[model samples]
Target: MVKSELEKLGLHFTNIDLGVIEIKETISKEQKQKLKSNLAVSGLELLDDHKSILVDKIKNVIIEMVHYSDELPKVNYSDYISEKLGYDYTYLSNLFSEVKGITIQHFIINHKIERAKELILYDELNLTEISYRLHYSSVAHLSNQFKKVTGQSPTFYKKIGKKRKSNLENL
Candidate 1:
């Protein structure tokens, strides 16, 4: 759908994946605005701002690390992020903190915890496997972090799952 739309505007896109479109030729302002408007009609905004780009890169890196990668990197996260972004870890950290109002570490932990919840809900891997997959030092460490964020143990949360639907009349 997106590829056809781009072609309709006489743009040659080498790649059109999800939110990305790779065009080889430079486009005029009118063409750019037309493309932007077309995309906006379908609820996609073109973000060309440098700060937004950097912030998005930071988020994508963390998301890929936590959710998609088969194995967590052996190196510390700071080194991993620096290598991935080709920028000093400190600079990335400062920029992320300023824009997102949280440290990168916190962001990573939040993703990890969400993954942990999904794994627990899936009822496939044991806590030990999950801890190792996510690179927590131990099950105890994972439990502590999960409890800290959720106010409940992972086991307790999983067991609770969802209560039978409540009735408003019962109130």
Candidate 2:
């Protein structure tokens, strides 16, 4: 979708991926504005500012790791995010909190809890399995986080159907 939009504007790019686009040439202000407008039509926003771009990158990496990866990495998340973005964990955490108004750890926990809700809704995984899949240390920990975040238990969520689940984008 994004690639086609860029092509429509006659822009050249060396690479494009989730949360990142590398144009082959510098685009003028008008061209950037046009591209932003075009992308907005598809519910996408261009992040040209350095801090916003980095924050978006942080969100993307966390989202992918939490919601998409088959297995969560075993390393500490701060270490993982820092290594992934090549910035000090403190720097990234401060910038993320300053811009998004939430700590990185809080963001990851929200995503983890949401993913757990999704798995619970599927009815294919028990709480223990869901905890394991989400890399929680134990079922109790997962249940605690789930209850803290959603005001309900995982079992309650399973019995309640789909209303309690959150759309990933909204988080």
What is the number of backbone collisions in each predicted candidate, taken in the order shown?
0, 0
Q: What stretches of model 1 exceed 4 Å from their correct place? A: 14-20, 162-171
Question: Candidate 1's C-alpha lDDT?
Answer: 0.87
Alpha carbon deviation, residue 118, candidate 1 (Å)? 0.9
Cα error, residue 125 of model 2, in Å, equals 1.5
RMSD of 1: 3.8
Write the residue-wise lDDT of candidate 1 on 85-168 in tens digits.
899999999999998999999999999999999888887899999999999999999999999989999999887763311333
lDDT (C-alpha) at residue 44 in model 2: 96
Worst 10 residues of 1 by lDDT: 161-170
Pairs with steric clashes in candidate 2: none
The Cα RMSD of model 2 versus the native structure comes to 5.2
Tell me the whole-model lDDT of each prediction, alpha carbons only.
0.87, 0.91
Model 2 residue runs over 4 Å out of place are 1-10, 162-171
- The residue-by-residue lDDT of candidate 2 on 38-68, one tens digit each, is 8999899999999999999999999999999
